[model samples]
Target: MKLTVLGYLGGYPSHGGGTSSYLLESNGFKLLIDFGSGALLSLEKVTDPLTIDAMILTHYHNDHIADVGVMQYYWQLHAERPKEAVLPIYGHREDIQHFDSLEWSGATQKVAYKPEEKLNLGPYQITFMKTHHPVTAYALRILEIKTGKILVFTADSAYFDGLIDICQDADLLITDTNFFANKVGQKWHMTTFETGRLASQANVKRLLLSHLPEIADQDRLVQETIQALNKPIQVQTAKTRLAIEI
Candidate 1:
């Protein structure tokens, strides 16, 4: 299984960075995790947008789904598109308005996903866990069926005890580190301290700090996490086009 960081900045694009987005691939199948601001442009640098097999959204935030409409437009007007081709966008139905907008004419299909059910898409088996955010969001655990490699995405959430179990033994844990270690008592996103603690307690093999804050020093976030962990582990900050194999 291979994972690529398309965009990693938390809320908005700055310093030539985009918001949260990722691409996961296995056995020639491409799965897009989010389509945040500047994501489509970044994605075009790697692969054709029409080639994406499916997209799963964690929530309806603009930073997370900003380019979704443009993506539909791209498929609708692209001359090279197959006549029967249609993109499947997987999302929760908690926000009916946003969920309904996922379907765009015949260009895309909206597929609802329940947190309780497991999803089988291409070469992966996925499970969802609801996150503690203002809006309904879900963290995803994706397992490569053939390789048994696990990848967990924390999506957007605050620190919670359930996250440890959800990320347990994951080969890669991509966490939402949207705040510094000093920022505490927040309910929307995790801090570097919480991210480090989760990765350590969950025993993840490798850690990728994503959904990053735009103003903070990126290296310091990594260093703080390492200090909080107090252990040797392969840790890295997410950057556009950074690819890893698991």
Candidate 2:
């Protein structure tokens, strides 16, 4: 299994950065998690848009779904091959209009998912857990069926005990750490301290700190995260890719 960090900027992007997005590949199948702002441009650098098998939207937040419409149009722009099939996009029902916008290009199929739901796609078995965010966001627990290796993505959320259990024994934890340690109780997001704490408690094999807001200092965050853990962690952004043999 291989996972590429396409973009990790939070609500807004920095001069040359972008919001949350990741490319996960397992058993020759490609899947995109969140099409945040600037994600389309970053995605082109890693692989052909035409090759993506599916996309999952964790929520309707602008930073997370900004490129959803554009992704659909990317298909129609290729006139030679005449890509007719709609891309399968999984999202929540609360944001139907955002998903529907893809229909304008006639190149997307919307698949709604409920919080705490479970489903299978290719070689991955995925479970979605409701998160503590103002809007409906979900944390994902994905298991690679062939190897029993698991990955948990804490889409965007405040700290909660459920997250610990949901992420238990994950091979990797890709978490959203948008705020500083001072903002611990906020409802919409999590702090760097909480991000590291959750990973430590869950005992995940590896932790990838992401969803970083541009204003925060990366070095400081990494230092603080390290102070909170006994294991190794990586501060990742676009093009930072990791391959795991499960």
Candidate 3:
């Protein structure tokens, strides 16, 4: 399986390097993890969002779902004719409602699925678990049934103790890390320290820190996380075009 980091930040309007979306593909099958406010622009730097096979959302924050309307426009204008355009969308029920309420005009016609239950998209089998957030949210686990490669994506949420159930033995775990150790224990979002500790405890093979707070330095934050972790797992800061094969 091939995984591409299309974007890897939370609050973007980023003046620097970090972006806010992620794309995963294997055997011609494309799956998008999150499409933040700037993701469409960032996505254009990598691949055409109009051609993606499916999209999954972990939450409904503006930074996360802001591109849905734009994506619909892309497919409607730039892509092939009507019969050739189809994309599957999976998200928490509330997320579905929020997007639906946007009444994105022609966009509603493209809904393939609303994640009524555990479902399959392209090469991946998916399972959505609840997460702690102001809005109802989900932590997504995608496993390639044929290869048994598993990847987990946590959208935006505070560190919850029961996270192990969603992340055990994952090949790659992409988590939200929006603060430092001293600033953890907030009502929302996780710090680098908390993420490293959870990844270590989950025993996932690899950890990718993402969704940095606007004030955090990417290099320093990751370095601190690496030192605090002190584990054998592969840990790295996520970036654009960075690909992981599982």
Q: Top model by lDDT, which number?
A: 1
TM-score, prediction 2: 0.90
Residue 127 displacement (Å), model 2: 0.3
* Cα lDDT tens digits for candidate 3, 89-155: 6655555567564344444342433444667778888887778888877888889888999998877
Model 2 scores what on Cα lDDT?
Answer: 0.79
> So what's the TM-score on candidate 1?
0.98
Cα lDDT tens digits, model 1, 104-180, are 98799999998899999999999999999999999999999999999999999999999999999999999999998
- Backbone collision count in every prediction? 0, 0, 1
lDDT of each: 0.93, 0.79, 0.75
Model 3 segments more than 4 A misplaced: 16-19, 82-84, 101-116
Q: What are the runs in model 1 whose C-alpha is more than 4 Å off?
A: none
Model 3 backbone overlap count: 1
lDDT of 2 by residue, 103-153 (tens): 544577888766656878778989988898888788899898988999899
TM-score for each of the candidates = 0.98, 0.90, 0.89
Best TM-score goes to which candidate? 1
